[model samples]
Target: MVTLRLKGLHRVKAKGRIYWYAWRGGPRLTGAPGSPEFLASYNEAVANRQSSDSGRFRSLIALYRASADYKKLAESTRRNWGPWLDRIAGHFGELRIAQFDRSDKIRPVIRRWRAAYAETPRSADYGMQVLSRVLSYAVDPLGKISSNPCEGIKQVYSSSRSEIVWTDSDIAHLKKTCSAEIAQAVDLAAHTGLRVGDLIRLSWSHVGEDAMIITTGKSRHQREAIIPLYQGLRDILGRIPKRSPVILTSSKKRPWTVNGLASSFSDAKKIAWPKGDDLHFHDLRGTAATKFYVSGLTEREIAEIMAWEEEHVARIIRRYVGRQAAIKERIQKLNEARKS
Candidate 1:
């Protein structure tokens, strides 16, 4: 008898019957060990696994990861995109580049994959965005595909938060109910109009006599955000003890992580509001924009300070200041009628 050694050949015994496989959980092999049919199946499976196009999605993803375009994305953006890229690769790794070029054929398949996370519309949209970016890269620099199938796909989630501004009462309640750290965090965010990530990363060194000038984190230090130091902001800053290099620290006197601060804020919100707690930390940006409008800052100035579009600044003003003007006019009319 002769013994034959085979790579990636797996054998299983079940119910008193022996079965051969190319590998565990891989295609089943036909015929006896060393038989022509068995060898053929094993060779075919191994060849498929070794083919360049077997992991075409992964290969494209690798090229994109190394490309200058992907490298230029903000650090936080890249971090958020990492998992979605992995999911795309996992779902489509075995596909050929030619298949992606057939937009009609591939679009339905991509949609089906996206539909799996339909319950999480935001997440699904994010995944779609990542997939679209990858496919766009393939279309342009790689030339592996003719067009992006994800182009012009309607996003499932839509929201309008223009009217959502944090009230003074909401701030007072948060300050009263939450810890000193969280309270200071809220005040800093309300005054500076910084995003949560930027807020946590703000340092005392960024503060100057007239204004706090620092390049925004989201801009990858390419654009500067200039926040004026008003009396209210000065008062808030004067009260906070600098325990770390960063202005806002955890209860442990360490720099705040984004998730840590968000979790803390969420718990504080639950305790303070208990119900009807629709306000978010991001709403502080809108509140600060409203404050800027009231302080006589032009729409352009406010937009520059907050790195927002002028149209967005105008919308905030309309929602808050315009409404106030309407209410004041109504009251004046009522008072005049009473006097008559």
Candidate 2:
């Protein structure tokens, strides 16, 4: 019997076969010695393990990825964080976390990412935010890093793009060119005031006889709500075949991954919406909220219906609610005062 010692390779015997896995955490890889696949797996594992043990960015990110808090993040947020985190881990991942904690040391790295992603300032800013969280996690629970370098770094806000309520024309155009799944996704997003992430995860079980009853996942403090199963949303739901556990499915009848949904929707937008300024799926949620307000629902009432905070509902009203209607209400007060 020979004792095998490989830095990142752990050999385990299962079902009369041996398997190798990266010591830190990753997918399993198998390659017999002297085989090309084995060599590639070994090399890749060694690299990942080296970075993992180096007490660097990947090490901290790995910890954060495995955290319960990470799982608690909305699917959209988690999806957004992953790429930015990976990019940060790639550039600064080699440095020790302590080394990364130094403001002076990390400034240059931050500057480069900012410069590189200058066209999309929000992405750069979000990268900094993700870095801040990763460092914070390392400090509180993992206790590996002492300071958060992302805190002091200034971030820009160029990603703030205004949204338009999808018009009847817009819906008609989309319906003409897009698949039923994507078009229905559009309808569901606008008709229900739920975020795209929440809408995509809606299940058959969440369906009620006259309403959609489910807990939304936009924020950490999740709240359940029941929106009436109106004709539009009900039509979309009724038409979608029960292919997977979730109501929203791809043309293949498979469930959508966050990236897949984003990509598919983006493609749909480009093809079906070639005429003017494109609308984001999230704008539909805002559009729904504004409709709720114009339909004479109070901000608090809207909040209750949407399972959102009153403050959030108010914010949406401030941005998108009809100003003419607001002025009309104010004029009624003036008329009352004259009558008095």
Candidate 3:
């Protein structure tokens, strides 16, 4: 037997199995050691780590990508940030990290790069956010920068979705026109107020006699969102067949991936409301909040259930419930006038 040692090749043992990685905390290498497939993967990972613009933003970005800080981020967040990181690298890769110490010098440049995506304000803002995270990592962990220039940069996109709850008409039309999967998704979202990611991951095990309990996917604190088992939610759950451990399944009876669910929902939206006002799957959160408010839940109680700020819950009630309450009052007045 021959022992082969390769530079930067790391080996580890865990749970009675040995594993090989390209480098410590780097990408895992597959195939038997010394095999062609293993060598190829190792080489690719090493090649990616070599930065042509060393000591510059490109190198910093590379280091950030490999750091636990980046890896520990939510999978969806990492996926969303990947492209923006590339864009930041392309734009500022050659700029020396020392240059970022001066906020005035780097802030304007970042803003200018952000302006390129102004037509899509949300994308523009997201790009800024991703860039900021990388730079923040550099400042704290790497000590490459004196300060983060992205601080206090005003986001170009401002949105108030208080009025965006799905109406009964919209839900009815969606149920009639969309596929069963999409209809169930909408119903589950409206009733439980779970984000799409959480909704897709919901299972029968999470349901209790009085409430559904699960850790929210996007919560930084991994907080458990406890939603009471309302009749509407129970009815929606009763109608769904237990094809998989996950409550929501695709048309093929497999668990729903985020992209899979979004693509299908987008198509369903077009067919179901071709001429109607815009509605998003996320709006169902507001719908659920409204329902909770109308059912006599206080803002603080709804906030706890939804894992949202109490202020945000209040805003949802003021927008949705306030209008409904006013309408009910007007109808009562109309009936009284008719009697007079």
Q: All candidates' lDDT scores?
A: 0.80, 0.72, 0.82
On TM-score, the candidate that comes out on top is 3
TM accuracy, model 1: 0.67
lDDT of 3 by residue, 148-174 (tens): 999989999887566678878889988
Of the candidates numbered 1 and 2, which has the greater TM-score value? Answer: 1
TM-score per candidate: 0.67, 0.60, 0.68
Q: Candidate 3, TM-score vs. the true structure? A: 0.68
lDDT of 2 by residue, 221-316 (tens): 468766877676777777778888898899988877677888998888888757656577777766676567656677787777688777676666
In lDDT terms, how accurate is model 2? 0.72
Candidate 1 Cα errors over 4 Å, as ranges: 1-50, 54-58, 96-105, 143-146, 160-162, 242-245, 250-255, 293-303, 307-340
Those runs of model 2 whose alpha carbons end farther than 4 Å from true positions after fitting are 1-58, 71-86, 94-96, 99-105, 119-126, 142-147, 152-157, 167-185, 195-210, 215-225, 229-276, 293-304, 307-340
Off by over 4 Å in 3: 1-55, 141-146, 159-162, 179-181, 219-222, 239-245, 249-260, 293-304, 307-340
> What order do candidates take by TM-score, descending?
3, 1, 2
lDDT of 1 by residue, 84-117 (tens): 7767877997787778888888988988998999
